[model samples]
Target: MSSASKDALPLRHPVRVETITLRPMTFEIAAAQPDFAAIARHIGVASLESLKASYSLSRNGDRVKLEGKITAALHQTCVVTLEAFPVALKVPVKLDFVPEAELATLAAGDTGEGEIDIEVLLNEEDPPEPIVDGVIDLGAITLEFLALALDPYPRKPGVSFDETAPEAAPESPFAALARLKGSE
Candidate 1:
């Protein structure tokens, strides 16, 4: 295999916050999901073929900025046909992590979990995430993006709701009564 392909392979990296200085550290890393089957089951998908991310980390003041893109391939069951179909995604990753100790005070009535009404929540950006123990879990962050990118209701190409399809006729009350009597 060519060296270019080797460099493209996803590699796992656990970066310590202290290492990220004013200069941006670029990475083209990807890691194979060893527990792909189990995770696919938990994610309610047919299967996960691949998930990879390529990004850079830089320190801006006290916070660390993570900017990258996550690419994933998976099979999702179509709601219309109940058939699994392939899905490819290229999701943008942009988040900032601040030292846990330096986190700002919670807003009024905030549960520290950060909450906003639906209307404002749609437009508001999330607060910076906390960098716990000075290490960043790049794998976990990439997986999170994949989860968010999945379609809640997936449909295969050329498939749609068929309102013209025949529906099963409802049984009469007497039919159910007769069935119970016959069973007894």
Candidate 2:
């Protein structure tokens, strides 16, 4: 989803497609000791105190699936109060990677039907990313998912946006006359 996102994240872990097979391989990936300073700058968060990723990679013919979890603790400035608050994220990463040649097929078969069911909507899959030059950047891909999981509007707990509803309109200047005329 973010091909044009920040210039290829710093922690690059390239996995060659030819190396994977039907058997799944598990891997844990992360920057040594969080590197909160670097992550905050890359993703533009108030601060990313911790970040971790672990997943299993498996191949089925041309489709490569990365299933894992990305855990992170960050601080986002609240849009309502402008105060930085802590937020914990556990994003599920199910990135699908396919060769450039086969990706075209996935895009061409999109039906125009709109989804209405909550289950279907929640299960909507992300578009498959291309395995460029026989390599997939799992580190960058996982971080991209982390960035997407950030809340655009982060409000601290107990904060509520209460909008006052209009109570009643003031009486018109000719209110008494209008009432008397109606009685007649």
Candidate 3:
């Protein structure tokens, strides 16, 4: 378990993915450590912990597809009351990584299609390549998936929508009287 720095609002942790050399791959991150606070901040949550993920990677020529399951505990401030609320998530994520060159070729209107180059796509400029050992970084993926899954507005349990409820009248006696008369 790695502890985060106390000064920053968000914490940061390094996750390592195990390298693999096969297709239809399966990887595990047994009890991977993550900077929960940082992840929470990234996802606009109050806090997070106990994150884990397991996944499989498949390569068909130059296209890499990843499918995985993620589990984590999260805390966030209630949108209605400003109180802290905890949430749990168990979600599956699937993604396709495509090479920039192929994207460019396709964009430029290339017709005759050939096989894509996986190595070239893996070596793209931004966003470092995913670590792919037998061990995967469950923590990082959990954070990412959680961010995608999180609700922008979170309310406490049992909260209900009341669209039909009457809106509060303006804080003037005349306005209140007018509303009351209109309702009648």
- What TM-score do all the candidates reach, one by one? 0.70, 0.73, 0.58
The collision pairs in model 2 are none
> How well does candidate 1 match the true structure in TM-score terms?
0.70
lDDT of 3 by residue, 1-184 (tens): 2223222323223323223334577766544345565556667888776666677877655555678897778787787778888899888887655555555565445344655434435655433233332233444555567678887898889775556867876599887899899998
All candidates' lDDT scores?
0.77, 0.80, 0.61
| Candidate 1 lDDT tens digits, 54-83 | 888999877999999988788999999999
Clashes of 3: 6
The candidate maximizing TM-score is 2
| Winner on lDDT (1 vs 2) | 2
Off by over 4 Å in 2: 1-8, 109-127, 163-184
Ranking by lDDT: 2, 1, 3
Candidate 3: list runs displaced more than 4 Å: 1-22, 30-34, 110-142, 161-184
Candidate 3's C-alpha lDDT? 0.61
Top candidate (lDDT): 2
> Worst ten-residue run, lDDT, model 1?
3-12
Once model 1 is optimally superposed onto the true structure by TM-score, how far is the C-alpha of residue 156 displaced, in angstroms?
Answer: 0.8
